[model samples]
Target: MKDIKAIAMYLPQFHRIPENDQWWGKGFTEWTAAKAAEKLFQGHYQPREPLNDNYYDLMQKKTMEEQADLALKYGLDGFCFYHYYFKNGRRVLEKPAENLLKWNDINMPFCFCWDNTSWARSWSKLGSKLTWFDKEKERVYDGNGVLLEQKYGREKEWEEHFNYLLPFFQDDRYIKVDNKPVFLIYRTDEMACFTEMIDYWRKLAKIENLEGIFILGVNSCNEKIGMDGILFSGPSAYWNPIISSNHIEYENRNGIKCFDYETIWKNVMIAGSKKNVKTYFGGFVDYDDTPRRGSQGVAFINTSVEIFEEYLYKLACKNLSQNNELLFINAFNEWGEGMYLEPDKKRKYAFLEAIKTVKEKLESVVQDDNEELTSALKANKGLSGNVEVINTNMEKQNGKFKEYYFLLHRWLQLKEENKNLSKYFMDHGYYRIAIYGLGVMGKHLIEELKNTEIRLLYAIDRNPQLIYPDFEIRSVDDDFPRTDAIVVTATFEYDVIWNELKKKVDYPIVSLAHVLNEM
Candidate 1:
């Protein structure tokens, strides 16, 4: 059965519960340390518990029970706790996680996602001096926009953190692979400091008489995390703060201001489509951490459960059984950071409903025949919906909505006309044409036809800048006469580009892949 792997619980350490509020309620008003510092100096806010109201308190077993309850209620596959502390205080990450392991003895299974970034306000910390907190609100008078400060653990502090994981490594509930426990590190680049972090982890795992657990680093941080396995960015977009190095500016198809998370999730899957890495599909309910500092003026985490269900459906179609590829969710409950899949007031059971729906659907057809699978695939052909774009003729087009609708339309009509041409070429045993689009389908066709006469010796795109002097690069708007041209589009959207060519070119415009197969 396909595992509906999703994380929907929050680590008790960062989860701050306000005195008479529900678990998901905003506990404190957003205030950064600098703002707190300024406010303290200015007498605006006072500390409730001396040092900080958000003190590390995982000792509360009651909260731990609540955390486990949220996990079970949401149909989450596992839980991940953010491991960190304020400055050089006591080690706080281990307590809550340990508590969960104890709770899981008879309850649900859980795992740990190790976030290795330094605990300074300068990096991952909210309201620290190094983010876009105050300037976005125009409240503070700092340097306006960007803040870049490097506050990581010194050599000793990192060692202490690593050492604390020994017990977690031994715990069977700790998600592991083979015999070794599996630990996920947040920023892969941070692994640079203790070049031997992985080696040390292995050595420790060996000493503990267990198959050493691996430390999977962030996909953005591709540098070796010294573990046996690595974690790929699943469905939810993820960014390696250490890799992007704090370059937060990103845009999506709608030209919306996208954080780095959106960029990776949307772009990376097709970015290196030809690469050979086995990827685990990821899913998430939402990702908005701005609440930590009380900035509620953004759509940081307004993701719809409907969209999330569609993603799960896709995973099910791809044969992601529980015993096979694991579907890692972005979080269980980073409630303070606002990426919870659990039930909330505004949309009670919305996310959990998605999980159950996907789970039930996937389980129902677990052993389905090829015909059923094919029907399912076709039914959800555009489950991601149409990538609608207004073409030059103002007609809307779908599939890969990049450009040239007229050309795309003509190409589809042409393909229908020459649908029987494939058998003709196969009878002749040889045919060839130049191929366009070096994307996923194009690459696959190229590989399949490698030994055949329908060989594509050159690949091209519409982009002029990439058009090398020797390579054939033609823009759709260009008036180049279609000689022996075969318009190979990766998907349906480009069919419009082909239709545009029909109006001008009299020569044969064929399916890019079909012609290549003939060659």
Candidate 2:
């Protein structure tokens, strides 16, 4: 059961456009409030106004297309727009999410996470008033009367909330398990009666025939606040019963406890059975609630690309050897929280690379025998050998050696998989070839074989927006050359694409590894 897949949540505050612009503090065109709100709403519920100046600037700088690209690049299981409902109960998550869904229906997978929290002057309010006004606003909670928040729900009120949420619950993008839709409760403590609130929800879901489960975002200290939490298991949630905190302190956004993977994971397994629900894990990049909290802010965890990649790879390796059934990630595009895998101007693709590496490693591990650890190691043999051997060696390396090891490991994986389908020369007659989807591995393969005879057929991708040269390109559904063409693809969800291509062509489907070996 260790053969579990990973899922991630994407929160795109198109409203954040202005926020992004302001944070970056440059490169934004003048826009009116009405027009900005209309454009920002795009496919979701309409906003009363464009997000405040901070958010408006963010949206003005980055488009939805940019956001979608960032989600796919990270290999997320799915994405959910942060559908908001407030101010006389207005709702908007459908349009933009649907639009994103339409853009990349096949290759890029997605799902939704309902961010249900209050919108108040105290909650939404950031920084102090007065000349300190020059300072960025910091989100501060008074903790005076948490019970009085307008969004606080009695059991019946919670049911009413879900009633309004029924449309999204029926959609495929809504996360589900065992035929039940998953719903996360943003801040559970806000409920006046924590224990009674959950019991009521359980009763309501059964009565209404709705699949509802509330996931709480518990702060530090690890106290059992009585609601189920999204638990972390090492670097990934491959195994069940992840670590639990009696009370984990919440230090602004993204600033929380940093626990050790080995210690935490072992504890989680035993606790998981007692908890009765599957636990999850997440990897962190850098977190800066500074936008919401100013100079008296929380410390950010420095998860450089190198660290992020290694943490995920090792976590995947460990999970592939476990008995868990499902996994979850912190997020896909929560730019405000700063844990996004999206490509920033500074880190081109540091986060996306980690996601791809974890996915490839997991898939490669699954194709091998799982009963014993030996088969896993054996699967990492030379070229077509087992992946575990390479993983094992990589772990032993110190410091900078890790990067070179991964580069070669990735190279080997491509060469092997490519060899299978790309071997037109030795196996068939050494025919030339081309690959579609010039993503990370595709670009790497092209670089490795720059001097070889296998001419790349015009590289194509589903993203009509990608601009690359030296090859013909087309959408995944477009009719193209398939006769004797040694075709390879670089997108994830290969099974989906493989099935699609099988319907269109008679040629054998080859991988980049197969193509590289012959070269």
Query: Could you give me the TM-score of model 1 versus the true structure?
Result: 0.51
lDDT of 2 at 395: 24
lDDT of 1 by residue, 440-510 (tens): 55555555455555545355566655544424665645556333555465433333445555577665555
**Candidate number with greatest TM-score:** 1
lDDT of 2 at 337: 40
By summed lDDT, the worst window of 10 consecutive residues in model 1 runs over: 387-396
* 1-519: candidate 2 lDDT, tens digit per residue: 345656665554444233325432233222222122221111221121222322333332245555445556655666544555532344543455555444444344444554545433332221122111123344332443121123333335656665666655566656665556655544332222334445556666677676565443322112223445544422322222122322232323333333333333333222222133333434444443333333433323334566666656544443343343345555555444445565555565766777877777666656764443345323322211222233223322331243234335645654555643334443554355556667766676667556665566666577867766776777766776743454453322333455566578766555443233223
Candidate 2 lDDT score relative to the true structure: 0.44
Q: What is the C-alpha local distance difference test score of each model?
A: 0.45, 0.44
**All candidates' TM-scores?**
0.51, 0.47
